[model samples]
Structures are given as structure tokens and as C-alpha cells.
Target: MTNPTSPRRHLPTSPFRTAAPPPAKRFAVGDRVSHDEFGLGRAISVEGDGTIAVLVDFGSRQERITAPFAKLFLL
Candidate 1:
């Protein structure tokens, strides 16, 4: 018999793991990009420094979004 409140056990495995189907790379500063939900816009800035950032466009009045470089596809 086991204690009902006992902590669950987990199998030992490699701590370091690689991401599957690595994210796509697109949209650099000065590059044009279009979002399915945000419509067309240009890459204003990238956040996370090494990850992604919120694209800004003054003409369309679109909001900024934090999207990963891999998830963003170049136009």
C-alpha cells in the first residue's frame, strides 16, 4: 500500500533537451512582416534581446505583440 498524499515519482532522464522542429527565423529590423491577426507591419523592434519583439505600425493602428522569431514567417 502507498500513502495517498505521497509525492509522485518520475523517471530519470537527460536534463538537457533540444527543441523539436526548431522555430522559424524571419523578420529583422527594417524588414517588412505581416501578421494574420495584426495585418501588415514592419519589424519595429525585437524583444528578449535574443528572442523576438513587438512589431509596430503607425498607419494601421495595430498593437504590438511579442512573437518568436521562429514563429514569424518573412514576407
Candidate 2:
């Protein structure tokens, strides 16, 4: 049985090339970004090469956005 927490591997001979996952988003300090909730902001600080956490200044307030960055988009 396979563990539910483990990712399933794609078969080499499989024809489903579209099943490949997209690359993780990368960010850097001083980069412009937008968020679903925060509107617009600029990266103030980044943790662990921007994959861990990012500090952003959204003018009205600052937020510490975390990984996966679901609502965050690079600009």
C-alpha cells in the first residue's frame, strides 16, 4: 500500500504529459507582487530563498505571506 502523504510517481511510458505539475513560484526582495486580498504590495523580505516566507508592504499594512502563496502572484 502506498502512503497517502507521499506523492504518486508518473509512469515513464505514460502518455499524460499534461499531468506534470507546474513549478513553484519564486519571489525576491524588492519585487512587485499582487495578492487577492492585499491588492498590491512590494516584497520587503524573503525567508529561505523566497520559498518559506515573504514579508510584504501593502501600503496600508504589512503582511507575512507563507509558502504555496496561493493568493500571491509575482508582478
Candidate 3:
């Protein structure tokens, strides 16, 4: 059996080689954005350097979206 504490073999085609996560989404005030559920909206404000949440104003309502904005996309 292979030792669990041993160094991992680096395979050229291994998916684990790249262990970095994707870049976070950044939005500035007044920037236009689209959401999966909230639809289109304008960025009103951001909190915690945008790592906490983002306030967006939709025509019908407003929402505070959090980090790792999967449904939120830049327009």
C-alpha cells in the first residue's frame, strides 16, 4: 500500500495540480449586473471590501448578495 504521508506524485494531466480557486467577483457602485432570480439590477454598495456582501437595487426590489456570487454576473 502507498504511504498516505508520502509526497503526492505530480501527474502532468492531474486535475489536482491546479489547486487554486477562481477569482472572486468584483462590482463597483452604479455597475449594472444581472442575477439568476432577481433579474437585472444596479450595484448600490458593497461591504467588507466586497467579501461580505453587495447591495443591488432591482426595479421591483433590492437584494444583498454575498460572496462567491454564483448567480450574479456582470453585465
Candidate 4:
């Protein structure tokens, strides 16, 4: 049974409505960069027509991180 005084339920939230931070644009392909967290790396690839993939060497290991060019600065 439903009560006439009961409050109405709200609709479920949508996940697609959320906004993402603008992509950074700093380096180009074949450019060198240094990250505070990743140390030193070189730009290997750019995808999504904006983001860049960096290959970093941390002495003991090498890793790759995709970030907007804006987040990285020219060295």
C-alpha cells in the first residue's frame, strides 16, 4: 500500500554527465620531458588527436604514461 503523504523519489543520477579535466598540451612527438613523479621520459606517441604517450626511465625501470600535452612542459 502507498501512503499519500510519502515524499516522491528522485531519479537515478547519470554517470555520463560528469565532466573531465581539460587535456594538457606541452610537448610534441620526439620531445624530451621530465615529470616530478615519472622522472625523465620522451614523447613516444600522440593519440586521440591530443594526448601524448611518454616513455620514462626511472633507472631501475621503464614505464609509459598517457597524459595531455598541457600537463607536460618543454625541457
Give each model's whole-structure lDDT.
0.59, 0.93, 0.88, 0.59
Put down candidate 1 lDDT per residue, 1-75, tens digits, no spaces: 999999655446857554466654644566677666666677676666525565657365855566554344457
Model 2 Cα shift for residue 8 (angstroms): 12
lDDT of 4: 0.59
Candidate No. with top lDDT:
2
TM-score, prediction 2: 0.76
Query: What is the lDDT for 57 in model 3?
Result: 99
The C-alpha TM-scores of every prediction are: 0.49, 0.76, 0.71, 0.41
Ranking by TM-score: 2, 3, 1, 4
Q: Stretches of candidate 1 above 4 Å error?
A: 1-19, 24-26, 68-72
Per-residue alpha-carbon lDDT of candidate 4 for residues 1-75, written as tens digits (9 for 90 to 100): 899899755455844444565656644567777777666666665555435565545456666666653345557
Give the Å error, residue 24, model 2.
0.7
Q: Candidate 2 on 1-75: residue-level lDDT in tens?
A: 779999777798988774657788889999999999989999999999999999999999999999999999999
Name model 4 segments beyond 4 Å from true.
1-23, 50-60, 68-71
**Colliding residue pairs in candidate 1:** 24-70, 47-52, 47-53
Residue-level lDDT tens digits of model 3 in 1-75: 999999776789886765667887888888899999989999999988766789999998989999889999999
